[model samples]
Target: MTIMCSAESPNQPEIIIAVLAILLTLVFFLIYKRGKSTRRSILLTGICDSGKTLIFSQLVHKKYVQTYTSIKDNVGGFLIDNVFLKVVDIPGHERLRYKFFDEHKSAARGIVFVVDSLTFQQDLKDVAEYLYNILSDDVLAKNKTKFLILCNKQDQTLAKGSNAIKSILEKELNTLRVTKSRQVESVDPKTSKTSVLGEHGRDFSFQNFSLNIEFAESFGNHNKDGTNDIDQLVKWLLKIA
Candidate 1:
């Protein structure tokens, strides 16, 4: 006379577990896609006439491009060893350079700071200042972005090698740190815009940073056979990508 409750199915628990596993898999797949999409960018920047445009073109087209001064950012995407990368060539003109840096700072996976190896001595201070700014940037430091100090124009006989460039830059950055310390001391702490490059009381070096900083030589311009030393840079990009 009284109605009886139906017994639960044995497969009900298995079905519920399968549903949860599928949902978790979907979440992980989405996260992997988002990370891959956001992490494949490299920023190319340095003083004006440092061969960034040439390197950009070479990477994109496999040939040197005859470029006038770049007034704005040059962005391109290419594949290396099947990994896609978006390389941004930020104009090195003093007035326009920083704007691009601010825009792309968070998206950058690595930074290529080009130096005209032939003219490095004259431009040493400028290069150091620019690099110091990058090393001290809160976003870059926090992200631990990889930095490549590319000694461009290395095909030229007078072009400095990567070792010389590294040594000179380290020395110059040390001096810059001392000078910046004095300037910071003179200004009100609240109003001072300068960020310290390295440890307070020690000499400045790339090793002091949380990020990996590397130095390498590259010749963006093609040789007589239409090849260049840009392969080294491409290798680095592949590694980071």
Candidate 2:
């Protein structure tokens, strides 16, 4: 028997080749699946103030959240192996109104409109109405959008209440409309035509929009909205992404 025994089996090379082929196939499959499911979102609106920004900042920095990460251009990123979300913060002020409107009209994956309940009542009706106008634009209504209204300054005396702000926003949004004529009375009497939601765009009033209000207590009282809560908000945003 010792005269002509072979040291290696004839099938050894075939087995090695088969094992490598199987591994290669698995890697290719994983790559394809990842390519198919990558997700990206852009959050663009000018609602950042002292408190809201804090909540947002917390969301970005919090380690446990693992949802969103900060990106270039002040945008936040929600990163998964296959999917990534990009969130943009818009400057909330009269001077920035034009640019804000322009971005809103574009196709944004989600919208977070932060409001300060303590100060919103000063001119809540007008500001809410204005927001409705931009959201109602034809281009925005049709896109996939999630709406969040951050009511900051909740620790304040008058703003601590939640239901009041929700009701105010609901009412203001419902009354918004777009008329062909600049003057309200000039709208066609015959057609009775006003741009109602769904015909042109998504109406923030029609319940199609998911509405939620979060109060960031530490937003500014503790060193500009305490870095803690901001991380929470960013985490929430990432979950949405």
Candidate 3:
């Protein structure tokens, strides 16, 4: 004698349905976990003594960092709004030029360019140019990397105005574009003429691509001023989230 099977059973069907539901729930959870683990990285690039470390410290603690010695190409995590934000502070000193700014080209979702508005001198412009060349590479430029130029040391006697720093940055970025155009033209005429790059890269024809200066803000010097100035930085970073 054998027992006949039906499509639906009193207990077996219910158990099968429950097992299916559990499997579906587990699949959904795995997807959410993968998305949550995808981290966002912001690169901090600038000349030395430009307060890159200070800015990172301030960002981590949501205040100002008065006394941190310069940090090399180092990675650190800081908590902002309960989410762990990763910051890579590239060394800005002239001596370490080849090490951080030149050889290593890491991918970054955003760029925080620190500028020492107070102590900034003419020579710093050269450093800025070098940075532009590195970041504005054909591949890197294509990335939607946001820039936050922190014209720090605003409380000092020699602090430059926001407009001045803006001029310098725009000029440098523009120059980098022109330099790239000339190089490509020399190498590949089609790319140089028909090619669209930068904000202007082949994406558009009539209008030229421009670097979006997303945010420009001031930060106080440690000796005289405190982290009060960094409130704007914090706000800007939060806006990105």
Best by TM-score: 1
Q: Could you tell me the TM-score of candidate 1? A: 0.81
Return the top candidate by lDDT.
1
Model 1 Cα shift for residue 231 (angstroms):
1.8
Which residue segments of model 2 deviate by more than 4 Å?
Answer: 1-39, 44-52, 61-73, 78-83, 104-107, 176-194, 197-221, 224-239
Q: Please provide, for model 1 over 1-241, each residue's C-alpha lDDT reduced to its tens digit, 9 standing for 90 to 100.
A: 9999998668988999999999999999998678656867799999999989889988877675678899989999979778888889999988999998899988888899999999999998888899888887888876668889899998889888999888888899888877786688688575344455666557777777667999888886554356577877888888888
RMSD each, Å:
5.6, 11.4, 7.4
| Lowest summed lDDT window (length 10), candidate 3 | 201-210
Per-residue lDDT tens digits for candidate 3, residues 1-241, read: 8998777546988889999999999999997665434435666777767777767766665555555445467677766677666777777766675476443343454567777787666745565666565555554455445557777778777788767766665566566567668988999888875442345543321124454455466665464354447777766667664
Q: Which of 1 and 2 is the better model by lDDT?
A: 1
> What TM-score does candidate 2 get on C-alpha atoms?
0.58
Off by over 4 Å in 1: 1-37, 189-195, 222-226
Q: Comparing 1 and 3 by TM-score, which wins?
A: 1
- In model 3, what are the clashing residue pairs, if there are any? 48-92, 196-201, 196-202, 197-201, 199-209, 200-209
Work out the TM-score per prediction. 0.81, 0.58, 0.65
Model 3 misplaced regions, further than 4 Å: 1-37, 61-71, 94-107, 119-121, 138-143, 194-212, 224-228
In the range 216-235, model 2's lDDT, one tens digit per residue, is 22233445333333443455
